[model samples]
Target: MNTNKTELNDQELSRYSRQILMPEIDYAGQLTLAQSHAVIFGLGGLGSPASLYLAAAGIGKLTLVDFDEVDDSNLQRQIVHREANIGQAKVASAKSNLAQLNRHIEIETIARHMDEKEVNELVRQADVVLDCTDNFASRFALNRACYAEKKPLISGAAIRWEGQLSTYDFRNEDSPCYQCLYPEDNGQELTCSQNGVLSPVVGMVGSMQAIEVVKALLKLPTLTGKLMIIDAYSMMIRTLNLKKDPGCKHCAR
Candidate 1:
């Protein structure tokens, strides 16, 4: 329950004036929000919105990790970067966008690829980690890091009008990890380029992912032990209660 409310001065107050007006996240919660740090993996379709929202919400430190470069194709869903940023490194572009949105918050960009060691370091440093990568390998990698470090994770994925989310490890001792939901190691999964996703789907899931991160940091009553599945086509959302899989290999490790 140790939180800070005086961290925001008159200038910071004026900047986060809108959010500070909210009862749930008033001056105190907004101060807590400003003192928190969230590290996001993947600067693609999902990561763009997640990072931007967290940064705008006064997250003290926002770290963006991705080695990919921006491309014309990414604009359809990656809202953090514009047409002019197409040729730049994705992490750099994302940082630029967030910095433009809020200068008071700090931005950290990792232009290098994330290996296991790097991920572990990030997990150790971050209050909440976000898994927004497009592939299972990266998701699993991040999951392992968060699990090992006992850090919370806000995971999200979207493909072809379908989006999914689940909160893991943030004091929910029995919540399922990402691998539990997807353990098959399927050879094929939908990708933005191949499966064709509506641009908003990514933002929708990404924003939700940001919400989960904020909740995790604030210990708010959000998706701590459930999966939120969203079907854009049907405009339907379902909550799937989850439990720890003792037989699961990753979290047990």
Candidate 2:
């Protein structure tokens, strides 16, 4: 992300008028967003809404990464891919839809798996990264990469009417990385495919992820050192403070 200021044209001003009206994100904040770049590491339930909202919010560039193909089963929750995109790659499908949403922004698609080195390179180029991936392996990989690059990472997960969101702003000295919260991957990761999930649960989480991304770009207060737990079943939401692990391998100095 370039700290250099960006000027919005008349059409852009008109497009994001509603957001710019907010005192927290006035013209200056919108300009910051317009000059920002975000990298998203999934195109499914969480990535779908997160990408859509970011693009709609006028983020200058977005790099979408996913190796999976769109399946008919994905249509139930992966709102970014339509029926016609069932056979297409998830990243390709998401890029096409996101382009339709905001033609002014740049959309990059990586429709293949990325190794740790490649993930780190991508994180290095991004102002922020969104860990929308489902599995523990992917989450841990992203956490490592973001911490190495000192990029803010907004992670979201949803399954069986339960969703959680957390922002690891590695740019902050005391901000905890994802590994600080989940220290071990016990090979028991639960996914929506295994456990059923309500459509709106992911939507709720993904939308919140987008909000945190915008707040991050604007240097506004975000959920950097806390986690938001959502229980749609009971209609309750709670916040838990997260402390950096002194002995954590990923972020410990």
lDDT of 2 by residue, 5-121 (tens): 458999999999999999999998888898999999999999999999999999999999999999998988899889998899999999999999998898998988888899999
Top lDDT prediction, candidate number: 2
lDDT of each: 0.85, 0.92
lDDT of 1 at 87: 95
lDDT of 2 at 125: 96
Candidate 1 clash figure, as a count:
0
Prediction 1 TM-score vs. true? 0.93
User: How well does each candidate superpose onto the true structure, as a TM-score?
Assistant: 0.93, 0.97
Query: Measured by TM-score, how close is model 2 to the native structure?
Result: 0.97
In terms of lDDT, the poorest run of 10 residues in model 1 is 1-10
Query: Once superposed on the true structure, which residue ranges of model 1 sit more than 4 Å away at CA?
Result: 1-6, 184-187
Model 2 score (lDDT): 0.92
